[model samples]
Target: MTDTSSAGWGLRGTAGVSFAATLEFDAVEVKLGGRVVLDHFSLTLKPGEIVCLLGESGSGKSTALRVAAGIQPVHGGAVRINGTAVSAPGLNTPPDRRGIGLMFQDFALFPHLTVLQNVLFGLRRLGREAALGQARAALRRVGLGDREEDYPHMLSGGQQQRLALARSVAPRPGVLLLDEPFSSLDARLRETVREETLAVLRETHVTSLIVTHDPEEAMVLGDRVALLRHGRIAQIGTAAEIYRQPIDLSAARFFSPLSEIESVVTNGHAPTPLGLVATPGLADGTAVTIAIRPAGGARMAILGPGTPGRIVGKRDAIGIDICEVSVEGLDLPLGLRQPSDAGLSVGQDVFVTLNREHVLVFARD
Candidate 1:
């Protein structure tokens, strides 16, 4: 039910084609070399919604994308596009007919073909004149119209990426699958291209599933972020939702470094070096692990106002000092990240304080 009239890339999608699509992986499981790569992986992307799939290497992020594009077959479960079962046990759909566009980490542009010809490669279904018009329009949409006749080798890295995107969208597919599309760009160029890419995606309204490992990238590019673990979805939510309310310690640690404390819950609370963290549903005497983020989670306090500690080590990272404080009762030094302007030094005597929201208490494994 996407409105193709204002589709983002400026090319009307294929005639009678859906402008955007609903994609689902219904408990899909993928195996390779007799090893499970996607274990009951399930996710759903709504029409025109952009979602980021995030995880560490070997966590099945790219595998999920390949499954969506029909490049990788699932050993169990099913994949659906706009409610049609495109992939399932005993059924498989060819990638070409699925109306899904794929952009790989390398951009995958044809070195010999001119930018325009590269785009036209996917539009062969249209008449030559119509295909040319669509390719040129797609090039223009991605700011590469003037480079139509230029070969892929002639363009810069960013331009080549744009050309690949133009090629992917020229056919006006209903969904776009991008695998670490910006990971290869230099930091500055990556930022610029990310913004431009997001703009086009918003304008075209193609349902997009982007796979990346960087947490910030997930937050910046996705309406919601899905984190994969061991070939399954560990947690999925808005960046703020996942960051503020992680489902477990592993989910919390995925977003940032953490200082862990082990204790037992008593009176519905888990006591830590900082304070008692609420364990609302846990029984008394239950073992628990409390975690605190180093940055903006804990801080040096007045010498007499908080738990007494000595700054045992310190290092500067991007203007923030990661101070390691040794408390008398803890086995591990607590990490406190604060602005260097605070003038904390190693061996400095100070008390430590923490915010309740910055503390997370979970059942010990």
Candidate 2:
């Protein structure tokens, strides 16, 4: 396929046309302090595709970004942009020439330089007048055009982020990398800023890779999610695919708040207090792990007929009412979150049932 990002700009009224670009990580490997940070990591982003890279700390999320940005050296493999090998064995392309833009977690604005100057920094290849025009248009794209004359310290946290985004995109990079771009903002502001950022990215149609620890944020920003585990791509899929059908036990645990039950498969079923859950493809007598997500997936009732349980406690957790239920034959109280208007409270007698949608069965190790 042709490289769509060759145009380098968009014709948005007066702005340049933004064509998308592709990014490829071919078996990339990186080690820091003799510790392997990334191992045989391979992923690709199509032109204008937005992918969210999700991983825990020390899981090579940032290292992956640095590798693509040409700031971190790889021990093996290659990083490619627009079909060109930028980082490979004995080949390292300077970041400025990589046709990519990086928006850092700290916003990384020059404290002394005006906003327009900072945006202009990346457009140096163009003539002075053209650079000014591109910088102004970029600022306007991010809603920071009026603040071009203001210093970084003079702007709010959200505005600073917008300035940084403008600076990164002013050069009309084919690939845009954002490292925890909204982590510094408060929850309310982060949502608004994230919406704005997603809009700009879609408008420009830039291939974007966002690094975030937030699952919800990843789902909101990414067209696909690439989950990393111990320097490897554990799973790569759409939000629904990853959330609904995880690759394994660890993945299921990572995506949902689960209550674990260890059971042995018997006659193609695993018996539990809820009922006989089907265990297909597992031999009889095989040990299996059953994960149940109680929040919004387990139905609890006070009047209907079901497995009887007494509500031991209840609390409002993140806009949901999670109740502790003590069922017979169980050693611990099961945490079951109820729907809004259930009006459930502690010490109430209730019936509990597992929603098959929230249940996951995995063969034990």
Candidate 3:
């Protein structure tokens, strides 16, 4: 029986154990060109759940996926699929036998092969009709029911990606690995195709691992997002948990844009130009970084008189305006959302107030 335990994101029931079994990587380490790509990396991807490996370029996100997919040999570590040992030190399982499907960033579709042929490529061992039936069904699941005969160049970018997804899931592998699969598509198309791809994965109950550097993408698609830093697993948690309670300053700033202000605890609250409300238990003179979200800070007009900032500048940020406030004694930039009142301007004095409860405090390390 498949496990269906609720764990992260408040996602329960069938959505919980979407993957049939956990893909386990124990103490994995990989080196490339004499540089450590991954060091003592480890994580468990539960069944029916999409786990996103999130990081920037060369942060070892893709390398982890390759290691789990049985493509890259590990320098030292163990990889297991459904609790079955596949690789460790010297014993490496061939990619074909690993029961893994890799969705490349470029889709990796054969230019010369038709959509049907590409999907049926893995189904070749079966009879022609049987292979075509499965391929057609997979294509249909991805909403590309009528594009079977189309060549790679003939399909739109979105359609081509859908075809690639169909081909990957055609074999119904135990685990599906996506390496920045949506990176190449245009934004609108990317969202549409990603939604479609996710829906199909849900319907088919395909256990998937997606690797991407984009945080928002990770939040949208993952059952849990694991942040990798300098070749190690930094933090693995639900989107809510990671966003709400990041482990350290690095992890905190990584997922969300946060401005850290050095503050000293006075009485119960930290004394700042904005005014201290209440933050108890902090030792006196203890230095701490107060994490302020870009969207949550208040403008001087909103905070009445006695505020401590001067309007530095303002910029249009897509939908909302982002106003920068300059505060004395704080080297960090204070970010505030544009207020309705147009009273503040460059060099205009204003007071900024932080909602103390929502503010996160991290001891300076």
Best by lDDT: 1
Write model 1 residue lDDT over 1-365, tens digit each, in one string.
Answer: 43333222323332222399999999999999988999999999999999999999999999999999998988899999999999887788999999999899899888889989899999999999999888887887777778888899998888888888888877878999999999989986887688778767876788999999999899999999999999999999998899888999889999998989899998988877777788888999999888889877777864667889998998878888878999988998998888784657788889888777778878887
Residue range 57-165, candidate 3, lDDT tens digits = 9999999988887888999989999988888888789888887788999999999999889999878777988787878877766656677787999988877887888
| Per-prediction TM-score to the true structure, in the order listed | 0.88, 0.92, 0.87
lDDT, model 2, position 302: 81
Residue 244's lDDT in candidate 3? 77
Ranking by lDDT: 1, 2, 3
C-alpha lDDT values of all predictions = 0.86, 0.85, 0.78
Clashes of each: 3, 8, 7
For residues 213-248, write the lDDT of model 2, one tens digit per residue.
Answer: 888899899999999999999999999899888899
Q: Model 3's lDDT to the true fold?
A: 0.78
Tell how far residue 141 is off in model 3, in angstroms: 2.6
Residue 53 lDDT in candidate 3? 91
Candidate 2 lDDT score relative to the true structure: 0.85
